[model samples]
Target: MAILKHFAVKNADYGAVIDYLKYQHDEFHLVPILDENGNSMLRDEFYFDGLNCNPEAFDLECELLNQQYHKNQRYDEIKCHHYIISHDPMDVADHGLTGEQAQAIGMEYAKANFPGHQALVCTHTDGSNNSGNIHTHIIINSLRKEDIASQLYTERAIDCKAGYKHHLTKEYLRHLQGSLMDICQREGLYQVDLLSPAAEKITQQEYHAQRRGQLNLDMANMEIMAEGIAPMKTKFETNKEKIRNAINDIAERAKSFEEFQRLLKAEYGIQVKDHRGRFSYLPSDRQKFISARKLGSHYDREYLLQLFEENALAAEQNQAQWVQDDPITILFIKSDLRLVVDLQNCIKAQQSRAYAQKVKISNLQQMAKTVAYIQEHGYDTQEKLQDTTDTIQSKMAKARSDAKLTEAKLKRVNEQIHYLGQYLSTKSVYADFLKSTNKKDSRQNHADEIAKYEEALQFLKQHSPDGKLPTMNDLRSEKELLVQQKSAQYETYQYFRDYHRELQTVCENVNHILDISQPKQQEQKRLHQSEHSL
Candidate 1:
């Protein structure tokens, strides 16, 4: 996938942009390396308007633009624009193109799009995530240099003003994405739908928060390791994950709609507001509210309401079961239990097939080894060969049994871990709900909060009928145990699997020797019979 990102530089010093792009800086070290004298030591390529500018003369050209466009309105507004043409790492690798080639593509695109503009195009080989994604930076002055009116006449007359600011519109950006896609396809590079909406889009603020939170968690873990103590959970959870989990818990309950709204406010400190038929959530801690639609399809009004209806129908059909099992356990019984069973069966099938294939391959190789062994060792007696074959067959049978048992244990432990994780996640939301409080408000405010609170309550009842859930510590302990057990089982399974292959090889080798000897013996017997008859 390729992305087109644009940013405006408001700083008066255009030379700063040139220095950052051309020079080796610690902040952006992925670009190119420089020696003690500050000259580039790596293959960092830069181009500007076809031979008029080099890295050394880049600042001079930018300064000339500033000098020519002195009549521009304000120094605070954007003076120049920086556009990035970034390609996917996989695409770059698949295309077998250098960073320079990628930069040239961006440069050509920029020139064609922004004619009569002084621009510096620099291609980079690495991305912020340390992935070797090929990207190009095209920094162009905001000032339009050419007399557009004199050059050409169109439906909309071009501004011939000396210092007209170049406007970037949505249509232009869309065009850039389409153009890049075409270029990628033509080059036979791996491409994705750059213009389509993403499945989940994380906002810049949330992204930064997650990164910061992860860094803090890492530092905390290091400290804990040094102290030989258990680490504590960080309070900084990304809103997206928190909200998604909360919504999932609520959706699963699917009680009355009114109860759903009430519980949302009372439990989670999240006020679900309806605005012109659209549902939005406003967290107590944040002033801004986000649309439910933005969260995902599950959180959409219709989908959530449908879940409530389904829950009601299920309760009516099986009142005894519904009354006996809590919402959480019911959820497990209905979905997770069945899912785990199916997954275990699938894993078993896959393992069986894989084991058979491995054994077959090992047997074939062993047969070849057996021929060589017989030729070298001169094993002429059938009795000695039969003894060796029996021993190998016995070992192969045991190995197969051991491998199967170990794999089954591993699968069970994994399923337990998965179940425990979901249970803990759902429990955490309920814990938050228990801790929340409802305060007095105006009639209208009360009405709004009441609606959300009722809905939330219904959600809780449907998800957790018994109202009693496992503690976080209990869940965590079980999870740790299961994870450890899984690790141990996996090691054992691998060992047995390797041993099984060895046994298969030995068995095949013995069988091959027997096959060769039996054929020779039959031929000898026929020759003996013919001699007796004569």
Candidate 2:
């Protein structure tokens, strides 16, 4: 019941598409213009051929389109020779109207919506023996020529240019969609609107897919966009290794799609749908999301296919993949893991700051109690009182200062944690990364680095005397040694990552190879089995 609208222009070479349809469906009568229930200038016609490719049907469609567009414009310079609008044919059959009746409704709708445009409507029906779907096509010519009244018997012919352009623009397309939606509602048909994709995360395929159902497209290949250029190509293997290492980076926290979707929607008015119920994913809400051919009723299949071919070629050149691999998918997994690790670190960092603040506050409170006790009992121990007071005052001043510093540090850390948490909430890359990394364990190599960092922190903390800070020199030397150790592990991680990327690339290619190979292998296995049985 969904309807889609697409616009296209046919050059002189294209002639008319209805004429082609006339030959395809050879059963129905093609009606003429003069006989229809409207006062239109063009000849009304119907299917001389059955439903799809009949001359009469083509002529009838043109006649209807002319009635809406040209009307009484006897001198319209540009005539729309062909326009095609097709829908699920079964909807028409349900109306219990013959093919002619369905064609009539389309013509009527065209006249009502595009008055003053030359309109032609064709209805194609798949018989009960076949699919039983009935669809209508409408072609409209958008230009008309103005006439000048000649004083005499037209001694000279007036040169008239077309007033309207041949093709529809964005505004016009929206108008088309609105009219179609209105028609669908009136006719009690099913309809769905598309969602656009995110701007920050723009990808070419995502952009193209959005346009597929809503616009007339030319074929463009995605390969061209996929091709890795100079710097990226030079370090392709190296960066690939980094990416793999990042992907395999230890996972500290994970959330299911349902949990994430709930959080995203509740926290940030976004809707996610897991196509096939795989996992909640934000659906693209853009014109490009729907393939022009997939746009309910108005999708032009041949035109869209041409667009896809062009897209495929462009994609191939850009990325230059030997086999098809979903790059967004790969990148998404890596990003998701990055977010998870960051989020976990954020929570831990927050706790550490909170603990530091609490310790500072408790220490300040205890120091304040000692000062109060000394002030209250000063007369009883006068001899030692002066020295004790001096010591307590120094300790109290330091405690107060430390407390203020701790509170300030905690406040800053809290702010950072809040901001990072917000960022992690919206970021899907982390979730994807979590899913991918969880699939394989690359934790053993990084484990030592993690242990060493923890050990350095512990050693620094343990060696520092109570209430004393470690010297900058000591901190610097400790950090330098840790960095040196981490660097070695980083190299190992890079090697493993590069090795993993190669494996993944091979695995991705294997899918395509197996698609063909599996059947042949099966065939050979069947032969072997038959031989053994014999």
Candidate 3:
């Protein structure tokens, strides 16, 4: 049985969120600590954050908090948190917990999950009828206020790297499901996926169809056509305009329709047809003369039409082949991939800083230990050692600060990677599905579908994938650069490891004062050398 499933956080004003929730459900009940007249004589702490606080007692406290903060300005600036710990109520009922009991269990789960986290927890009964699941809201003041030196709402130094305790990522939520599933086993609730799947499951066509309606396939074909045609760009409007301009240019010289048709067939190789028998515009002899003069040979009408249609279909077919190649490839090609670039850059920058910090910190620890040894154990070469120690300590402090900054960057990069992975995963699945399937439709419908997909692909090419457009070659080159960067990082890590170990050994020897060591100085020298190598 799986237990945990989906988790999300939204930043919003507390009051607005509460109001929305209140309005969204009529039967939704809110119990407060205070009476209707706003008096709080009752203070109960049976359950923290809504779990097992006696329902009667929970209601009282809720009322009290509401009365206490309804008019407070702080409520307007906080975010309301909500989550669900779902188990099949029917399954639980079979095990001994009734529907109300299951709802209570979920409420308790929510409450126990985030105690002392400055949050409000509540359970719902009619969750399934409302939204196919039972859940709880952990409404907390995004901005917390406490009398102690450390308060919940105070903005602490956020190492976004470390994430939050009560709040977590989609991945964390899935992990949390494990705990919930255990609870279900203990309480005899039906178990299911603890966290929702980390990736999206949408197919490419489905995803495109979400935004494009019925035209996704056409738009896709158009993109393929554009890819196939080397010299011509892949803009439908541009292509249409070019064709129209050619038509108008030929029309400008024609004194009659016959001459106009002859000019088109000979000069542009276009064959426009009305409901007449296959016929050429000019007299047979005159057309032959024009063909020799303009086209330098016998230009045939049927041959020109065939050539044009073949050219058009060839372009279209190549794009179709592109879509058919591999859905993941298309997804990789079509994503808003600028984030990937930005994240890669950020990670590289952070890794470099962390590497430098590791080296400097090791050197500083060495210097600190040596200085202490000189002061306590011996003073034969004290002054020089002290000077070196101070310098190392300073450098180490700077390194530690830099490392913190790097860690922050790495954390952000990781988060961005998670986001991009989800987006790309969903798109790839759908693209693959679209490429693998075929459908039957009227010829006109099929053509329209093709056109729609072409238009959508064009729009995606222009905008959705992020920043400026990149050529296929550019994508390959960028990947190559990332590979090189990774290699450089690996080298840095190697240097840090060897130097840090030597420094630690030197520092330990100095503490014992056993060998009257020159190792401390030697290690410091090595540290400097390593820095240069990086």
| Top model number, TM-score | 1
| lDDT of each residue in 1-534, candidate 3, tens digit only | 423433233443344434323333322232333457764332211122333233324334433444454522333432334554544556534665444655556556654444433445544434533543444444543322222233233344331211132335444454456657777777656676534332223332333333343244457667777788433333333222334455557644544445556556544544444323232233212333222112211123443445455656776787678768632222321111110012233555467877656645654555565555445433466354444445445545555555555555455444444434444444444444456545333323355444444454454355423443333333343344444445555544444444344334444444434333467778889999999999
Rank by lDDT, highest first: 1, 3, 2
- The local lDDT score (0 to 100) that residue 120 gets in candidate 1 is 76
How many collisions between residues are there in candidate 2? Answer: 107
Q: Cα lDDT of model 2 overall?
A: 0.41
Better of 2 and 3 by TM-score: 2
Q: Point out the worst 10-residue segment of candidate 1 by lDDT.
A: 332-341
Off by over 4 Å in 1: 24-56, 71-75, 147-162, 203-209, 234-267, 276-279, 290-534
Give residue 172's lDDT in candidate 1 (0 to 100): 63
Give one digit per residue, the lDDT tens place, for model 1 in 1-534.
677777788887767776676555553223455788968653344433332356456667656766676633477878878888778788755668677678778777876666666677788775555557778888777776665543232223444444576667666666777778888788777677867654455654566677778878888888987989877775567877687677677657748776676656544556676678667887656789888767765676766778889988877878767546433212221111000012233555467877656655655555666555545434566565455445545654665665566566456445444444554445444444555563333324445444444554454445443464333343344445445555665554455445444434544556555666698999999999999999
Best by lDDT: 1
Task: After the best TM-score superposition of candidate 3, give how far the Cα of residue 309 lies from its true spot, in angstroms.
Answer: 40
| C-alpha RMSD of candidate 3 | 34.6
* RMSD (Å) of each candidate, 1 decimal: 20.6, 31.2, 34.6
Question: Model 3, 454: alpha-carbon shift in Å?
Answer: 18
TM-score computed on alpha carbons, candidate 2: 0.28
Ten contiguous residues with the weakest lDDT in model 2: 332-341
